[model samples]
Target: MSLDLGRTASPGSTPRAPGRLGVPVTAAEALRYLTDLGLWIDARRSQLSAIDQAALNAPDQGDREALTHDLTVSMALWKAIADRYELLKVAFDSGRVGPTQAEQISTLIWGRLDVTPGQAGEAARSRVPSTADGALAVSLPEACRLSDAMTSSLRARLALEPTAMDVGLRVKSIREGIERIRDQIGLIPPGASRDKANHDLVGLEQRLFGVTERAKRGADVGGYLGPLEVDVAGRERDLIVAAARRVSGERDAATARAKVADLAARGDAIRSLQAQCLRDVTPAPKLGVPDVRALGAVPTDADAVDAFLRRLELVSRALDQAHETYARALAEREELRGLLGALDAQAATSPAITEDERADLAPLHTQLVATLASTPVPLVRARALMAAYQSYLQAVTTNVRGPR
Candidate 1:
């Protein structure tokens, strides 16, 4: 159930002002406050009764005694408050007191409800207004605040009891949320990402079944309330919230599709680039591209899809580096070829062809021939050959004419 977060009390209603020794001074102030208290208790009597019985059957003597004492005193207070309301009604009907005055008189009993010693007594003393003005001083809104606190306390106590509250409604809420998320994602086709997401969905469904089963088993079936039971409920609640957030109509689905499509296109672009490099570049280098065939699957879970997108991003970077390396190697081969061609042309035009000159050019020519014959010529060796060719051209020029 959703907790109300608005308007705890009626607006502009005055609470009792503190009086001497923190006790209610006027009967009217006490009556109003006690009336609020009585009504709150009436509303939660069934839950409180269940808790009372559970406490009585509790194994821990300390828990049994404490809960019993608190329940007894609270009931007594409620009854006393009820009795005062009746008396005030009678007085007002008989013309013995005005409606306002009679109302205030009933709240006087708030501080007088007998309580046993110890924690329950201390709680009662602190919670029950004592000052004459404070006794009946709470406005309707303040009373609401008090009622809410009481309801919460009762629920907490009930959670510890074997009379396990019907969790069906909560379970229903979670199921509904999950169904909405499922429907939203159903628009997508089957794929690896979707398959992974479906796997997680299956797990959630199993957990839901487990939660439902345990809830069916009475709290007494287990010795007492344990953290595991609470955790199950808590986890289900979290799932409900998560599913609720994930549920979106066509607009959201469109937006999500747009995002996925953008990422997928980028991934495809990298793959295409790698493929082209492999075909066009001599002695193709490995791009280490991930097998993304699974990405074609439609994703059901947002988280799973997000993770897949991240993997695509990493793969893109790797492909980018590999593509760059391939281009650089290809460029270096072209530049080395241009330099060797220039040297060969210069040698053919040399005015003097000495024996030493021919000898010098012969090995250079062999090295260039060997390099051209090989696929994916070694970059370092090609650069060295280009440098040696340049030096040879310079020597030929110096011998033919003179150093410039």
Candidate 2:
């Protein structure tokens, strides 16, 4: 297990508070700052719990007693800070605090708080003692500083000369890391890279063996063990990264190949559509359907494969645009055919047209039909002719109706 002592005080010393706590300009500001302090206190309480548990499990009697004493003092200091903080928080939360209330809150934050029973007033008058039994008066920040000092000291002692269990756990972890790295090394291809990585792993393994032996002999192997663990972990990371890159490169190459095949199919379909549009529709767009084969085979190198994929994407987009243009042109031609048919049918059944007028319009309609039905129909000319025919028919209808 790992302990994260967040924002710890500097090693071997209690943090000193400022000459005086600065009063917050507003109650809300005070509340915000206090809220943050409350979170820090909560974190410290958790750390103290872990430390207490570790102390209870301490193998040596002397170490256990010393840790117990430290834990007691730290807990007491924490309680002092926590108690004062809760009170100040309630005052601030009441929403009635002004400049005077702000000053009082500042005092509680920075001034020594008396935690001694039955001596609160006397403790305020006399110079406060730091002993565990006497009038223990410590400000919120001061209590934190003192608690941090003790926590740091205990943590340092444990780290410098960890118990047999700690040593065993550490050794087991390092061994596991070495094994993982060795497995990762097998993934590297047979080349200078693999050989060099294998050589580095051998050296780390030797160092780990030596450290394990020192730990067996009950020596302080922390110095050797810590660095060896770091080295092994770093090598593991490097090998994992290399393996990831190789896998990624393989996957990218496969994707690039798949994209190429798909684009080829699309290009073929687009070409067929283009042919049809050119044969049947006048003024068809002449955009070229890109030949994906021109991009060549996907390269083995990662960067080259990436560039290849980018080009494939461009080709795919161009194919899409070309396909859309041709299909739209063909659709428009069909639409014009439908419109012409509908108009001719309307004119034939229209009561406004006399038999003599129908005879006169019949040849014009036939000529329009022939032009529209011809291969490579001219869209511009078709539109103009349709418009003129519709206008002439409308004019005859209007004349028949006579001033509607």
Instruction: Give Cα-based local distance difference scores for all models.
Output: 0.50, 0.69
- What ranges in model 2 sit over 4 Å off? 1-168, 189-193, 209-221, 241-255, 299-310, 355-367, 394-400
Task: Give the per-residue lDDT digits (tens) of candidate 1, residues 370-403.
Answer: 8755765665666677678777768667854555
lDDT of 1 at 156: 48
lDDT of 2 by residue, 1-404 (tens): 11232444322222233236664435665655565666667767877777888888889997887667656766766788778867776667565777777777778777656654333333222222322234454456645644554554455445533455477777786677677678778888899989999899899989988988887898998778656655665466456445544655676789889889999999999999999999997987899999999988889765576678778889989999999999999998888789888888888777888777777777778777887899998888877877777787877777745553
